[model samples]
Target chain A: GAGVSQSPSNKVTEKGKDVELRCDPISGHTALYWYRQSLGQGLEFLIYFQGNSAPDKSGLPSDRFSAERTGGSVSTLTIQRTQQEDSAVYLCASSWGRPGSPLHFGNGTRLTVT
Target chain B: GESVGLHLPTLSVQEGDNSIINCAYSNSASDYFIWYKQESGKGPQFIIDIRSNMDKRQGQRVTVLLNKTVKHLSLQIAATQPGDSAVYFCAENSGSNYKLTFGKGTLLTVNP
Candidate 1:
């Protein structure tokens, strides 16, 4: 793809339901990241993957939130038993895994839990 | 627990005037900084970036200034236009970690 691509631009799920968001990073980019932006809030780091190294999951908010990058390209974020507080925009970005590389962000998936 | 913060939550400037947005970070280890502009219903777009080795960087009509002494970063927009009205965020990276810590953001409104 020309840029980071995300699926389901918007989602509305009931509380306690599970939701899955997907991201397809640019070709050849080995670094991918996930972030969450609450209404009127800053971007919160969730996780990151660099090449084949172990993913840095230190930023994941809770046990209910998890993500995985397959084949070093596409990634998916899964939220189990979602809560109303989880309503926010989930953003995905990718980089070349090189020094001074800038992150290219996707439009994001706006999730609304009712 | 290092964090990035902004001095002002909102800034209103007249069109054609210069606008300045400020950000402060707690981590001295951070070596790279970037400014992003986000419009309503859209994702943040990179504006400009500066490395710790330099105090300033310029791009198009925007300039980013880094003051390592005070752990402060600022973005200045020349001749602010209506299209420039958006929320600005500053992100800092520690080079080694490759993770970016973003500030809350400052809403810049350009009044015509």
Candidate 2:
């Protein structure tokens, strides 16, 4: 694909339900990132992947939030027991992670936990 | 509790006028800075980036200036247009790492 792609542009789920968001990064991009944006808020880093290495999960807001990148390409963010506060736009970005490489972003998945 | 913040929440400008959005970062170890523009219901798009080694960088109609001395970064848009209305965010990368810390963002409304 020419750009990073995310699945299910919008998702409406009841509170306490589990939601899975998928992201397909640009081909040949070795680094992928997950971020969350609350209403009128900035992008909050959630996780980062470098090839097949263990992801940097320090940014996950809670234990309920987890993500995995497979084959250094596609990635999934799983939010368990989603709370109302979990409602937000989940964005995915990919970059080469080389010197001076900028991140390319996907349209994002808007999750509404009612 | 470290984060980047913007000095202004919203900026309104007339078409063709120049616009400036300012940001302040708390992390002194941040070495790389990037500016992004996001439209309604869309993801952020990279605008310009500047490394700690340099104080300024220019791209298209946007110029990003970094003042590491005061931990301040600013994006200046020349001849702003109605199409330029969007939210702008500044992100900082930790020294020698690409982990980005983003600012709250400033809404730029260019009135035609």
Q: Taking candidate 1, what TM-score does its chain B reach relative to the real chain B? A: 0.98
Chain B TM-score (each prediction, in order): 0.98, 0.95
Candidate 1 lDDT over A8-92, as tens digits, reads 8999999999999999998999999999999999999999988645458998989999888878889999999999999999999
- lDDT minimum window of 10 residues, candidate 1 chain A: A50-59
When candidate 1 is compared with the true two-chain complex, its DockQ is 0.70
Q: When only chain A is evaluated, what TM-score does every model earn?
A: 0.94, 0.95
> Which ten residues in a row are the worst by lDDT in model 2 chain B?
B92-101
Q: Which lDDT tens digits does candidate 2 get at residues B13-56?
A: 99999999999998888888899999998999989999889999
After superposition, candidate 2 runs with Cα above 4 Å error: none
Question: What docking tier does model 1 reach?
Answer: medium
Interface RMSD of each: 1.0, 1.5
Q: Give per-model TM-scores.
A: 0.96, 0.95
Q: Give the winner by DockQ.
A: 1
lDDT score of residue B86 within candidate 2:
98
